[model samples]
Target: MSVDMYLGPSKTQGSTTTTVCDNYGNGLNSLQDAVGNFTADQVLRSLAYDSAKGYFKEAYVPLIQGAILVVEATAKAVAKLPSDYVSEVDSCDLKSSELEREIQRYETQIQGMQNQINQVKQLLPVSSERAQHLREANGLISDYTSAKAKLEKQLQKLLAFHAFSTMIFTEVTSLKSAVNQGLAQVSGGKGFNANKGTFSNANLNDRSWMDTIGKKWQDREKERLKDQMPNMDGLEYKQIDFNGGKVWCWVKKGRTTADPEDIEKSFLFNDWVARMLEKYGPDYFKTDREKGVTDLLVEQNLRLFEEVRTGIDSKTGKKLTPAERLARGASLVNSLAALGVGAKQITNVGKGKAGQTPKKPPIVGSGRKVPAIGKPKKTISAPGKKIQSVKGKPSKVKAPVKGTGKIYNANGNPDLRALRRPQFDEVLKNGFPDGTKLNQHAYNSLFKSGRKDIMIDDIIDALNSKPISAKPGSVEYINPKTNTSVFVNPTTKEIVGIWPASFKK
Candidate 1:
């Protein structure tokens, strides 16, 4: 049996009911099929696999080599230098010197280009040849500017890496000494404890002990080289600092990829990646946030992340202003009491477990009792009815409808016509016909809304719930059970359109 998942009214505030994912596991798999087409997911998959292999080889490999060189130098200094001068040979200090020299070189080149442009501009006649020279000089200047910008960014990362490496200088020196000793033993020299292990003078070149020592060294290197590698996390919503702004990203939760395919496989299982990409940019999937694409997307779009995390005022069903969020407890209580309920907790009720299937949140209109956690139960007790309690006592009576979204006629009674639609009834009883087709309009709506992950079967399942008529020969079937809706042609039995709870504005 599929695990039952409940969703609140965050996505469908005006709807009569909340959502429930009855087939949680299967429905999530279908959503995965939907997210495969997202550009952000595609970008992450590429970076963590073969497609970005060439880029890593050309760009990251050199950074790794440079960092290793600095590491080796620091280790040598720590081992051989006197305590007083050891600080002078620090890796970060050495990198800063190199970065200064590189910056000076770029500045000199840019100055020369500017001189040529100035000479061209000062010419008495503006000839076509002179204009061409001016254009070339300007182009050269632009290239230098871009190259210098990239170099500074890369060097900054290297500096941070070198600084971090200094914390482990003692360990690196010890490992290096061990490696040197192992080499000496392999060459029949007096090094390592030959008498303590199986490596006697006769079996000098035996590599069994060396292999074990090498494995330990390799593990340390992996930890040291994390900055230069593409490390992907599992499926989860993790808040990370990206491009000077905080954003919630799926690709960077607190974990590491076990295999190359693990990164891509993780992407196949969630919509947070799609939401982040749609909110920020394609760089949302970049493994190295420190060395990622430098842009204003994150800074510009962080409000959405904040809203998703903690913004909605539960009592009013409106976004809480910054001032309102930070108000003194008394003022906050008073304001909320003025709006409606004073005791309601104003927190994100829909933040589910890590990598859990995220259903559309309920748009909680005023006066509805917000659940203390997650969402209300999958079933809504019929209005005005009392069920026998688990203890076998009659439950308290429920009040009649207020201004909530439950379907009601003009005279304020439950609309039975909406409660019973024959087309939906037949589909729930016998399933859809073989020739039933999803039309172009529905596909367009889903694609534009980042909900192309909603499958046709999901729509059919949603039809099992109550429906309200929209027009002649058409009915709006909403199923909170499946978190999907279908506008159906009762006579033709074709799916005219769909509205999925996954849709985000």
Candidate 2:
């Protein structure tokens, strides 16, 4: 065989291969695979078998030297990093006495970086020392690479500081050239920011550090825009201040119309948002109060936040304004009173569990003025149907009665309010899908010819009684007499707000 060529224990070497062995490469592969899959103890046992010539130890001699060299190289690189204040104090000409504040700031930053690198080191497992040579080599390489990359990104910042330091006390021309060279080494593209007084457009591969702040800002914007639009309605635009000196030109709800003023404002706001994204690069939201590409591409923050609304009736497909809600509330109130239910009990219902706490009803006399609720001049009581009051006081039958059925116990007594609960449950089971705003017409239609007030509180209490899969915001109930269904808002215990079973809008 020639000195440069090898002869192996095979008769034939075929195709692309120039050499072959009798055991072939398979023996080496199987041995290496064994090293990976064999129990650590098994490997230890095998390694423990003594060779009279100390053959296993001899085999690792070169590997041990290589490990020593690699560890030395990593240690030298780590040492090159300014992990100590002695280096910082020595590198800068800052006197020990000249306003110690600046020196402390630099020292603190150096210490922080060192601490971060140490934290990364501490993450290595305690068992790593058992694999000391290989583990040390890998751990040192990973930690050193991480620390170096982190520090490299800030080199320009450090250079600027150096330049500033020397600008007052020494020449900065060489310092600027050194910075350009450093930038060239650290990041290949873009350099020399005169405005920022540092390098620009370098090392931007991972810029997600700002996402946390951006998400936080987005949530704040969503909450503000949804909180009743702050005395404005329809489409409009407003410039709001973002934290940390950032600014937002937000499209919001205001007086929306196709008037010249409104058109011009809309056009200008759209133009401004477009120009900002084009000029400043990608952002998360297109406009504060509207949907856009920002919603499509991001996670963590909500994509869109719709304006706050009073909501629409599910049955009639009509918007429920505050006045309408109040009217419906009053009607439900009348029904509850006729069934001898109280407002306080209705408001305090559903406080049994942590998440099931009920919201208080919009109380009358709690600020908003409501018409005095005296005798309805009309009652759910049938005409000419005189009955004894709960206190056993005889009362005259009221004229112009409202409801359509006997809303009392089988004994013909209103005081057995528990008897009324079954009827309420019956209404809950049969009358509504959920959030159904029952009025005189709907209530009257619920019966054949008599009047019975379905107390709004009774409706709320009944609705809460039905079982629902998942934590539902509402439940459905049916009116068996009319075979009509309605939906009720569980949170408000109101007969409106949720979209009704019969209505799509």
**Could you tell me every candidate's TM-score relative to the true structure?**
0.25, 0.15
lDDT over C-alpha atoms for residue 10 of model 2: 10
Per-candidate total of colliding backbone pairs: 8, 31
* lDDT (Cα, tens digit) per residue for candidate 2, span 1-505: 1001011111011111212221233343455354334323243343223331132222222222222222222222222222221123222212212212333333453444345335334543345432442343344334434443433323333333334332221212322233333334334323334454444334333323223323433563464343221222354332222221111122345522234444344333333323332322222122222222232211111111100112356456666543233323333332332233322222211101011101211011111111121221221122344221112112221211112223455675653233233434434444432333443434444342222333333344333233233236655654322323345556655443222223332
Per-residue accuracy of model 1 over 1-505 as CA lDDT, tens digit each: 1111112221222121112222332354454344333422434453234323432332223323333333443323332221211232211112334444555666686776676566556642477755665665566567556656655664454445444434434444544454554455444333223355222234234444344445654764674443221233334433233333222223434543223343333223222322433433433233222321112223322443344335455446797543233221222222122222222222212211111111221111222221111111222122353321112112221211113323566897865344323223333343443224455555456544345355433553355345678788878777544567678787876677776666512
Which is the leading candidate under TM-score?
A: 1
| Model 2: lDDT to the true structure | 0.30
The whole-model C-alpha lDDT of candidate 1 against the native structure comes to 0.38
lDDT accuracy of residue 114 in candidate 2: 48
Q: Superposing every Cα of model 1 onto the true structure, what RMSD results? A: 31.7
Q: What are the lDDT figures for the candidates, one per model?
A: 0.38, 0.30
Per-candidate Cα RMSD to the true structure, in Å, reads 31.7, 39.0
